[model samples]
Target: MKQAIAQYNEAERLARQEKFREARPLLEAAAKSGYGRAWYALGNWSIHGIGCRKNYRQAFECLRKAVRYGAGREALFDLAICYETGKGTSKNVRQAARCYIESMQAGDPEAISEVARIHYWGIGVKPDHSKARRFYLRAARRGDLESAYLLAEMYLTGEGGTTNRRSAIDWLKRAVDSDDAKLAWDAKERLKQISAVTM
Candidate 1:
């Protein structure tokens, strides 16, 4: 057990230094010993072909094992993405939503944003603006700029309930300060339009 952990640790160290090739064998060793993180790492590597051939089947298997062994939030989130995009498995929107929900339950804030998206778009699940609003609010409060931007739109359009220009403006202002250039630009543009209309 200790040896497996050591292998996983060393693999992580090597991967951080961009030595994926060197880390692969160690990760494989740890994964074979039932290390969840190692399985997660191997899954990601298989998906992206970092140090091995890109094999969706292999990626799916590794990710499944990782999740079974209690992988971290990222692995769960990635698994959700896989289900959503058919990366290593058949595209299954319902399964994707389930994985996203699981990821959220696993404490992945990003999954909150994804859940909001699905609700807002009626993807695989019934469209529920109220649910989307709730998820967006949660993610935004957790400092997710994209969620804040989406929340601002919801406020502006009254997607879930009554329109609140003030709330929209506040969220836009917060988005404007984001480091993401595209989001900041959109926020600035929206703020301008809002000001023009109000003025």
Candidate 2:
């Protein structure tokens, strides 16, 4: 275990410095030696076309191995992304949603945002706008900027149920203040519309 941990740390150090060629072998070694994090990292490296040619098959295999070895939210989130995007397998929204839900249960903030997205968009299941609102609220309260923006949209459109102009503006303000530029821009647009309303 100690040796595996050392190799894993070394792999991380090498990868962080962008020494992809050297890091690959170290990560492989650590992953083969039963380091779950190494497997998960290696999976990401393969999936993102980083350091090596994009190989979804290899990424899926490595990520699955990671989950098998007790990888936490990171692995599940990546796996869900892959499923949703058809990276390794056929695009399977149901599978993606399941993985996102699992990751949320595991307390991954990104996963929470993703699950909220799935709910809001009705990606893999029947549209449940109320459920979407609940998820958005959860993520927004946790400071997920994307969710905050979604909450604003929902409020403007009355998507969850009743229209909430105040909540919409409040969430838009919060999203605009956050670091996510895409969501900030979206919030800005909504805020403009809301401000322009003659009441």
Candidate 3:
């Protein structure tokens, strides 16, 4: 195990230097030796053809192995995306949701937002605005810009409960600080609209 980790670390260093060809064999060796992160790295490389040919099937297999070996929360999220989009496996919304929930349990803020999205849109399960609001609030408090925006909209429209304009404005204010130009613009426009209405 220690040897595998060492090999994987060397591969990571090579990869950081853009030595993809030199890193590939090391990553493969580490993965074969039961290093979960190596499996995850190989999976990502396979999916995008970073150093290998694009092979969704191989990506799926590697990612599945990584997940079984407890790769990381990010790996779970990536697996969820693959399941949701049918990138390497069959489209299975239920499985995707399960993976997202698992990732969320692992404290991935993006996964938390995804769970909120699925609940809000009823992608694979029943639409539950209350649950969406709860998840969005959790993600928003963690500084997820998208979740903050969605939570603000929910508060403004009273989708899950009583309308709270103050809460909506607060969330929008938080969103205004986002680095994303579109989100910042949208938040600013909404804030202006709200202010006009109140005036």
Candidate 4:
């Protein structure tokens, strides 16, 4: 484990120095030794061609290996993105949704937000406005700005059910206080638009 850690550190240093060619072998060695972080880093570098050629296949392989080692929610999130975008595998919205759910279960805030997104947009699963709202609320509670905005939107529009102006305003204020200025602005606008409506 110490040797693996040393090699991983060396790989990270090499990557930082723009020596991707030198980093790959070390990263691979560390990753093969059960260093999930190294696998994740290698996946990122390979996917973006950061000092290395863009190879979705290679990136996918790295991420998958990390997943096998119980990497983290981020790896699950990335894999979900890849599946959704058909980077290394066929575009499979169902698979993507499952991945997002798994990531969320692993406590990934972004995955919670993504689950809300797909639920709202009816991307892979059937349109369930209540489910979408629930997901948004879950993510928002976890400090996800996007989910906070989405929850506010749902409240203001009453898309899933009757509108709740009070909840909308409250969540908007929370969003603002959370320092998500973009979401705060959107929530404010939505509040304004729904101010006249009554239950």
Q: Candidate 2 on 1-199: residue-level lDDT in tens? A: 6887888888788878988888788888888888888899889988887799989989998998998878866799999988899988789999999999998998887787777788878888777888889888998999888788888888888987899889888998999887767767877887888888945
Model 4 residue pairs with clashes: none
User: Could you tell me how far off, in angstroms, the CA of residue 114 lies in candidate 1 after the best superposition?
Assistant: 0.3
Off by over 4 Å in 1: none
Error of 3 at 6 (Å): 0.5
Better of 2 and 4 by TM-score: 2
Top lDDT hit: 3
The local distance difference test score of each candidate is: 0.91, 0.85, 0.91, 0.83
* Candidate 4 residue lDDT tens string, 124-193: 7888898899988888888876677778878878987789878877787677665667666776666666
Model 1 poorest ten-residue lDDT run: 68-77
Clash pairs, candidate 1, are: none
Per-prediction CA RMSD (Å): 1.3, 1.8, 1.1, 2.8
Candidate 3 lDDT trough over 10 residues, lowest sum: 67-76
Query: How would the candidate models be sorted by lDDT, starting from the highest?
Result: 3, 1, 2, 4
For 93-168, candidate 1 gives per-residue lDDT tens digits of: 9988888988999898789999999999987799999999999999999999889999999999999988999999
lDDT of predicted model 2: 0.85
- Please write out the lDDT profile of model 3 over residues 40-129, one tens digit for every residue: 999999989998799988998899889877796758888888999999999999998888999989877789899999999987778999
Better of 1 and 2 by TM-score: 1
